[model samples]
Target: MTVLVSAAIDEDVEFERVWLDDASWVDVARGWLVGPDAVHSALLDRARWRQNKLWRYDHWVEEPRMGAPARHGFGEPLHPVIPKLHRALEHRFGVALSGPGVALYRDGNDGVAFHRDRDLRWLDDTLIAIVSLGQRRPWHLRPGANRFAHDLQNKGATHDISPASGDLLVMGGRCQVGWEHSVPHVRHPIGPRISLQWRWTSRRGHPVRGPSYRAPRNFSR
Candidate 1:
């Protein structure tokens, strides 16, 4: 099957870099996707979304949001714009970014807690790029000492960035290792939001883990 790219991206989009401690940084580009509304609606109608239940606190609980894995094994076609966006990122960043994982925030209550991307966190250096569609939501980042802290909300100061529809946010350097990020739950009513994420690892030969809330081996307090 031949995949076609979309013309929804702003070819001249410029990124504003935000540097953090320990060689971590984030790049932000507002209004990057020229057709965010159309893309979001298409995914809502075409993508295979599921409510994942995870093992949290010794019990299985439904995850706050709905997700469609990178490989939707049920013959589902990925958004055509996904490949176009990935290629754009790889060209600009000069790295092989892979897997445009999809996540849907149905409402204000749907969110993810502060946690590192398990596969990328332990690596020496990495990059995780995300594009936001639909409604706007705050993405919080803060330095963390714990490998898997269930609750780190009030521990220290946080840098918050609310990426509106069509915005782009890329976390790079040691951001995964030295910092944690989350889209906290909100109270007021809101429409659905979609996040398209892609990641790259400098040390592909090194072992990496999948998404988990539990602490990994060699984790220190």
Candidate 2:
């Protein structure tokens, strides 16, 4: 039997923060996870994956990418690295976070459209941390239409940050409300990429509603 191990985070790991308008910012940390190839392989081989269907045009259509089996409730078993990463994030960001919501983008064909996270209880002042594994892919971000209408009209620059294997990217400070993001499809062939995400919000106890990117079972009418 092979024992799975997750390397401890390096204390000296540095992150570059790019501030967007409306107090939104993105933090990128290159080469954060150690031996990401092994991690990606482990997830691909061991974890159960599912295809989610979305209610599109006239009927339900299968989602572009595959998702991990939903683990509802607490104390469920997770990857060895999940808890360690969660603790590190909470300690570093000074906020309590919940999750290891896993997403797998298999090849360039699998991508998500730009959208703000509406499922959270509070969109503003929230933070989401993601650790990327496997091939490099562009994570595109642009100003929200509600806040930066002029920028969009003027063809404002879209920020494209590619998180390679073992990289970490975080978005915070009104990002969900002030900006939109997506993983756009590409023509070139690319390997699978797995993202383990953790999220935090200071405004708690508010009723959580809206279409969640993770909840594909829900329909949009």
Candidate 3:
């Protein structure tokens, strides 16, 4: 297990930006690309061939209400560059990540419905890092009301994140607790987008699954 530090942000624009100049609450952070483009290109090349699964609507044990299009992972021993980014995130947050990271790709109008990533044991009220590559898309987040109301409500505090090639978004603490996030389907043609979601889990092994479906042990509301 390797320990890493976090990077410092010199500008506020890197932290918060309002969409449409509205103050409803759409916060985003973008990290600068540090190395050669070749590294990212290579990773994308390999990811295209990796196995992925489409999350079935009926199979998910929890939060079966929304869509879980596709999901995949990058196994043990992350790429060499990942540790450096992990270290920078740790330094920025003043805490260390507790487990291995995974990468997922969503394409063809596929997306994750409204939900939160708040079940990891190692997470313990910390942040999860998401890096976007390839094409840009809109990522939305809103407040979670009652179960019945949440399923019906589409307008809450929302953030439309248009992450360009090689951009990073970190959601933590209150952000994950009070809000639910999703990447809705786009009507226009969009190229495949790869997201590297860095998270900490207590489990030791990784299992392959469909694009939308996660392993039963890892599934939660």
Which stretch of 10 consecutive residues in model 2 shows the poorest summed lDDT? Answer: 148-157
TM-score per model over all chains: 0.83, 0.83, 0.61
lDDT of 1 by residue, 136-193 (tens): 9788887876434546654343788899999999999878777888898889999999
* Candidate 2 ranges with C-alpha deviation above 4 Å: 1-6, 70-78, 146-157, 204-221
**Distance (Å) between predicted and true CA of 164, model 3?**
1.6
Q: Is candidate 1 or candidate 2 better by lDDT?
A: 1
Each model's lDDT comes to: 0.80, 0.77, 0.52
Select the stronger candidate by TM-score from 2 and 3. 2
What's the candidate order when arranged by decreasing lDDT?
Answer: 1, 2, 3
**lDDT per residue, candidate 3, 97-121, as tens digits?**
7433444444646666776664553
Query: How close is each model in CA RMSD to the real structure?
Result: 4.8, 4.1, 9.2
Candidate 1 lDDT (Cα, whole model)? 0.80
Winning model by lDDT: 1
Model 1 alpha-carbon miss at residue 163, Å: 0.3
Q: Write the per-residue lDDT of candidate 2 for residues 140-214, one digit (tens) a residue.
A: 888765334544622333788889888889999988876888888878998888988888877844545755665
